[model samples]
Target: MSTTPSDASRPSLIRWPERLGYGVGDTACCLFWAIVSSYLNLFYTDVFGLAPAALAWLLLITRIWDAAFDPVVGMIADRTSTRWGKFRPWILWSIVPFMVAEIALFTTPHLGPTGKLVYAYITYSVVMLIYSAINVPYGALLGVITDDSAERTTLASYRFIGAFVGNFIVQGILLYLVQALGRGNNRLGYTLAVTILACGSGLLLFYVFLSTNERIQPPQAENSVRRDLRDLLGNRPWLVLFAMGAISLVYLTLRQVASVYYVTYYMGDRGLIPAFLLAGTAFSILGAMLAPWMARRVGCKKRTFILLTLWAAACNAATALAGPRDLVLIFGTQMLGSMPLAAIFPLMGSMFADTADYGELKFGRRATGLIFAGSTFSQKTGGAIGAAIVNLVLSSVGYVANAKQSASVLGGLRHLMGTLPAAGGLLVAGLALFYEIDTKREREIGAAIAARVRSVAAGRPSDS
Candidate 1:
């Protein structure tokens, strides 16, 4: 394990108000994101009139853009100096564009098929770019809000609760809202519903800007981008987490996209889509709520993360046995699977913060924004890979839009929804074991970084 000078002082405890303030941003983000990630594939195929092959390419292309884009945003944010702080300023600046891009994503324009595809490409690309601008900073802000590992866990839980709330609302009410708003026109309903959600998302982000503060300050000396990139490359913990987050996202994206198809076709009850989404996410909240306590009991975040993820994998794999007629059993298994998944994001996020501290301790500089940016990139990349796989699998199985699926199609859907996610879960669990940062090591990094900050502020050289 690495070592640095010990500091007696620890970061102050975060208040509930500030914690809630930080959480609301994710709620707003998810309002846009949950809809796009969970429902976009459906919208593209069913309403937007895109072929599965086209949608697959679209997902891959956009995520490739994110691969380059997210890291640049992170690097810029790190080099940024502002009265509002490095991360918080972007949150304030990007809100309008973010909202506009979201609205554009759900808007249905009457155009030729090629025109519509072009519009989809432009709008979706803009939305993701804007998302990186806003959300990359938002995630990096978690590191500055507080340095306490335990407190970060608590904050992550609250953040995910807010995320779950957004998911619940979207899954439970969005379609109904669209139905009510559109009356007979699906296009109009989607537009109006997303418009309302976009406005709400913006307001919540404003609250985050107003309510949170950046407490942990980065180093005063400006480092070259090359140096920062070099540091990032050497960050072992961050690399482990980056890989883990990517794999985790693969499962999450696949399962969420597949659930819509599974309900619409196999279950033959599109009405139950919202209910199914609601139950799974709601149970996930319970899992997230329990994460801090579980971490404490296990004596490390890695253990808690690994155990919960594997449990979710088991639950997801069990769904393979449930046929179309096993409605109650299917839903029950989904709820059970979601419980462990609920904690996964929060736990992993807290762990990432640890990795950030580790990077600082080892590299003699801090790059919170860059680290989380890498994480965000991994997630988007994972989503891209997963989405492509699902769409291609659907096409290969002869899944026709708005028609009864053949047995091959049903089998493909089952594997996509069940086996794939379970495999991802196991992969996450396995990769986590390679992560070196634990609670004790995290606390040590914090202390060392704190001492280094003090030394720099006092015009003394840093020991690292």
Candidate 2:
């Protein structure tokens, strides 16, 4: 275990620059995420003309690998030692490889369908694996950054503001960037755009390495993966978050991955894709900014998350009735849907961090990396299921790329945005109801952990 004098004291205010810089890392992570979440399925579809079923298999398999791999990475990260700290060092180590893999994932190789399918598996796996290596640790960084529960929530807000900024950059500009850079070659445009953005993402991660410090650690230097797993499974708050994370993402991914096809095919305007996505991104930023205030005002992060999740889903469901030319209805629902969707992320982050505290206080052990990684596992699994559902629906509906669709096919797209998300949203809200930690409980946990860490620090003077 490691603890500075400051670590012995919970609620120490982190300076603005460091907090901002830490948040900036999420911006980079989210930038890449925007690409994958928003466009990867489209890329796979157009790249080789694979059946949507094949593409669904591709997404499902790769994401399954990605989800399962998070816990292993988290375990490794928990045991890691370095001058830079356990989590930040992973960012430094993985950033370059991550960029390389990102570019590879976007590059379109000339090949037959079978060859292309194989290539997709290889490249997607590499990119997703590299992403897990960096991202799991980065999420874990929140738990170690500060012990202050309120400050942790505040920092989570800033982190997601950076996230929405990343989404803004990609949503508002990537298509235009691809067009301008491609000179009318869609393949070339994606390659060039991804390459440019990959470099920027790498630089932002490097800034995180330079700007952040790890201040809190467990009371023991020893680690037990079995214990970590056992503790995680037994932790009620973690279990609720785990379920909520999965179902919420299943809903979110279905809509996000469906949006491109919906806009181009159902809405009858390809140009509307960028605008539609941007409206969601812009409002997501508003949601992220409002989350902390709302949580405080609502008297608990858990309650705020429930309200936002339900509202977001209802808004998404309402979009089902919109006609092809109902621009107001479509965009209005998008803005309404995205705001609450965005707000939930920071609250989720804070709640997960609180769960880590809850585990240590209860179990006499700490593994921040493993706990956050479990959260990631839930989210990635949900996203995989959601994406798989989208692909299966498209395949079943006789969707032909860049072609006019039947009424039923268009109806399928509308139901994806509406019906599927509503069910998932209700499940997520219901799961959230079981989350026991309020702001009051979170503070009590933090203070108790601090006192124990202080006792351990006194016994081991060298740690101070």
Candidate 3:
């Protein structure tokens, strides 16, 4: 098994239009996710009249379900083969069911508390499973797209840009659209929001299906699910990265859910929620835009560690210091802190691909699906933990559902929103400190691998 490619090896860089198309689809999917993550709790507590503890249980259980299924889905994807390629077929197959599940999640039927809980469970579980189906493969597709390290970074940038745009649309514009659509009826408004999100998600999936091409066509490794899992566990770097992913998921989930309470209760300007979210998202886009250039200079892992540390410190300080009167300071801090997060996504994706390569090199089996599944599992688990924490914190602080809170209660909510997430961010940065891969090292590995592949193809004996 050679690692390097010959001089005549086909170039792996994707065309720009294809990249843009993939970006659009990814953005749309993220838009739906952002809406769900940012607003679902609010919708349940305020709109659906579900108690926080009850909602927490529902979320927790569903996430547990999701966590259980993620690895299985990964194993399935690894074993999958089709004319369209392993990943794309999953993406294509998931479109309709994914849309239906998403719409179901947001549909606010006039149901009793028991009915609502049932609905939440059924819809959330289905959506999560379908989401895992598409998302795992979608993430794994990055490795399949190209073997060129720099180009992979470029693709990651485009992907992050798409994610930023999706976040912007969901957090920045979706609420306003809901208001416009429903006017006076909150239920009708949210329903409209769900419809728009579902349609957008479907459209984006179609775009991804049409635009992107899989280049690194490794023959599907014929392995049992147990063997694939064992192979993934054997990859030390991949295991480390999976640990990092868990930390990141916690940080991201806290950030997403807390921001809503911070704006609504602490800052006393529920209207500014969109502005606050947009500011951070916009900064994230800027950060992603700068990643390629920065990675080339300082290497992806080191740059990520440095920036995330700075972000953690700034965010924590901002949370601890900001009061109701200090709106500008609070918002400014969040925006500045979010920039580093933007840079992290693409770099993280590149690292996962690198781990995929390392796995192939060491194990002589490509378990891209399994690797990507670890990422999905971490993120979902994080979201689950965050949801549980948010609910527990709110309940502990005497957060009464759908009622005006006392000043002290509001202050407590603010702290949970700001300080807790800041702390999580700090933990995430510390965890990332152990990431040892650097761009120079990655390039060297890529070059060596390419050379080995080339030698083998040329019928010359080569050492790899």
Residue-by-residue lDDT tens digits, candidate 2, 1-464: 23566655435659999899888998999889999999888877865467899999889999998999999999999999988888999999999999999999898889988998899899989999999999999999999988777788888899999999998899888999889999889999999999999999999999999999888766674477888899889999999899999999999999999999899988998898989999998998999899899998999899899999889878977898888889899999999999999999999998898998898888888889999999999999999999999999999988888788998789899999888898889888988888999878876776676666666656744221
TM-score of each: 0.96, 0.96, 0.93
RMSD of each: 2.3, 2.4, 2.3
* lDDT score, candidate 1, position 456: 67
- Compose the digit string of candidate 3's lDDT tens values, residues 1-464: 12234322655557899888767766867967888788888988888788888888888889978977888887788677788877888889999999888878888878888998888888888998898888888888787877777777788889889989899888877788779998977878888888887888888888898788776755235667777778888877677777767767676677788778878877777888999999989998998887788777765665655676566567756766777779778878778877777787787887888887777666657777788888778778878988877877787778886567887677666666567767776776666667656767676666666665666678886576
Model 3 per-residue lDDT at 256: 80
Residue 36's lDDT in candidate 2: 94
C-alpha local distance difference test of each model: 0.86, 0.88, 0.77
Model 3 alpha-carbon drift over 4 Å, by segment: 1-11, 219-222, 455-464
Candidate 3 clashing pairs, residues 3+ apart or interchain: 3-449, 4-449, 4-450, 4-451, 4-452, 4-453, 4-454, 5-450, 5-454, 6-454
**How far out, in Å, is residue 264 in model 2?**
0.7
lDDT of model 3 at position 410: 78
Model 3: lDDT to the true structure: 0.77
Task: List, residue by residue over 1-464, the lDDT tens digit for candidate 1.
Answer: 11222322545558999999988888998998889878989988988888898889988998779767999999999888888888988988999998888888998898988999999999999989989999999999888888778888999998898888888878887999889999978888999999999999999999999999887776544588898889888999889999998899899888888899998888888888998899998898888788888889999888888999999899889888789989888999899999888888999888888888887788767888998899899989998888988899888898898888899989988898898899889888999999998877776787777777667657898786
